[model samples]
Target: MCTEELATWRDVSLVLLAAEALLTGLPVALILGASLRRLSRLMVGMRTVLFQARMYVWRTGEVTRRAMGMVAAPFIQLQSTVHGLCRALDILGWR
Candidate 1:
């Protein structure tokens, strides 16, 4: 093989070996890390959705009172529950 191809193969082999080591010693870390990455991505998506929904409710300039605000609260609360995983979920899951 060419010199550059040989170098790339060696680098890839090193990475594979490191991954094998990690899997052998810290399989849970890999699983939890993947889970955390997914959670972070979900939070990012939820953040964008909540931002747009809040902007829609506020900038409409038509729903600026108790009834409108109350109607908006449930949606906001739903988003909050999702974002925060709710008080109960947090308590149960963390413990």
Candidate 2:
């Protein structure tokens, strides 16, 4: 082929490649924008959930601590009394 004709075909090929690239890239850009929007919303929701979970954990820990404190002395006393009784019974050969 003549150099001019070959150059013309090369130009056409380049135009076609550029057009195809634009067509392919446009949708990818749009999809990425949509994905970013969705991701932003998801992040906001996750932040709220994490905050609520942290609050719940703090409240539950406080309640548990108070409940344990209320039960602690009684529980210790009961355990010691049981131990003493067992020791006395063993000394008396009542086991």
Candidate 3:
């Protein structure tokens, strides 16, 4: 009779523990699922914002590079002219 009562108590305790785990774990799982859903949505928006920022930076870099090349053109041309004149003078034995 004591052994039977012990078995019954053990079974009851197991059931209670199962119920407690279900009660706690289910809400935590649901909350985690909801948070993941919200995070995925936010990530979609962030992806688009990052892509736009990248395009803006690319365009700005392209414009700046073109402007720098334009600004340096006259100096490059003058240097080339001077080098050619020096070469010609050397070839003519006039240096």
| Ranking of candidates on TM-score, top first | 3, 2, 1
Residue 41's C-alpha lDDT in candidate 3? 96
User: By lDDT, who's the top model here?
Assistant: 3
Best-matching candidate per TM-score: 3
lDDT by residue for model 3 (13-87), tens: 999999999999999999999999999999998998999999999999999999988999889999999999999
Candidate 1, residues 10-33, lDDT tens digits: the string is: 999999999999878797887889
Q: What is the Cα-based TM-score of model 3?
A: 0.58
Span of 10 residues, lowest total lDDT, candidate 3: 65-74
TM-scores across all candidates?
0.31, 0.54, 0.58
lDDT score of model 2? 0.96
Runs of candidate 3 with Cα error greater than 4 angstroms are 59-95
Candidate RMSDs in order: 21.3, 6.0, 6.4
